[model samples]
Target: MESTSCEKNNVVDALTAVEMLAALEQYRAELSEKDRVIADLRSRLEILEGVNHELQLQLGRFHDVLKPLTVQLTHNLQLSAGRHEQYALPTGGARLKRLAISAEPVDVGLQHTPAKKVPKNDV
Candidate 1:
């Protein structure tokens, strides 16, 4: 009876060990997948960082180029402003009113109307 009881305990322990091994294998597989995902994300982050650095460099270059142009533009504006009695625009709104607001009427029903074909490109 003692031996039989020991055998039963041994069988239960063996089954427990097998279940533990299976769980460990499953956990190992999950860990490996997570590691792969982490590596992929890390690579993508590196690429984004590289692009950001490149863009930053381009922005710096553009700032350097624009500095002189901005200075020149400001100087030119100052000169023009000095030439005018006042810096403000003319008060009459005459220029704005000069724009044509409506299209011209087409004489489509006229007997003299002839359909002009587009010229062919000979080249």
Candidate 2:
């Protein structure tokens, strides 16, 4: 009788090592892809932040441009509301007045004049 023993123990270890290496490689690849995505997102965020900052600056400029108009409108509203005594212009109001489009006053229709009544005899 002849006894034959299979020595495939090393083969199993080698196969397991190869599979582990392949899994590690795949994991590395996935991590690199995630890193790239994160970097791309970061860059996009930066660009959006810059655009937001620019928009904010533009909005501020627009506000600055419209400040005089706003103040004038507020003053007009106050005048219309008969709050002329309460409404006082800021120091910059002088400059805004100089930039006024027209020196003509705007009528809010609050003035009233009494009409004299004459008695007439019945005909």
Candidate 3:
């Protein structure tokens, strides 16, 4: 009987060990799945960061291109205004001189004559 009891206890211990090992394997599998999910998320974040950096670089390039154009446009406007003033000054002076010359008075004498009018109803 004693040997039989010892054998039964051994069998129970072996079975319990197998059950514990199976539970540990399940927990390990869950942990591995979580690690894989975290890795995928990290990869996606890295891609997004790269894209954002590229966009910022492109924006800077656009600003660089626009800056020269704005400066050129301002320079052209100033040059055009200077030319307009240079050309207009002589014409304005000439116009003023002509106006002064033409404004001199010219006089003409009027001759007076008396005229008689007949009434339409009498005619």
Per-prediction TM-score to the true structure, in the order listed: 0.61, 0.64, 0.47
Lowest summed lDDT across 10 adjacent residues in model 1 is found at 88-97
For every candidate in turn, the CA RMSD to the true structure comes to 11.2, 14.2, 20.4
> lDDT of model 2 at residue 93?
38
Candidate numbers sorted by TM-score from highest down: 2, 1, 3
The order by descending lDDT is: 1, 2, 3
Residue by residue across 1-123, what tens digits does model 3's lDDT show?
Answer: 999999999999999999999999999999999999999999999999999999999999997788667655755786878743233322211331232354333443322333358899989
Q: What lDDT is obtained when candidate 2 is compared to the true structure?
A: 0.76
lDDT of 2 at 116: 53
lDDT of model 2 at position 2? 25
How high is the lDDT of residue 123 in model 1? 32
What are the per-residue Cα lDDT tens digits for candidate 2 across 14-66?
A: 89999999999999999999999999999999999999999999998998889
Which residue segments of model 2 deviate by more than 4 Å?
1-6, 92-123
lDDT of 2 at 58: 100
What residue pairs clash in candidate 1, if any at all? none
How much does candidate 2 score in TM-score? 0.64
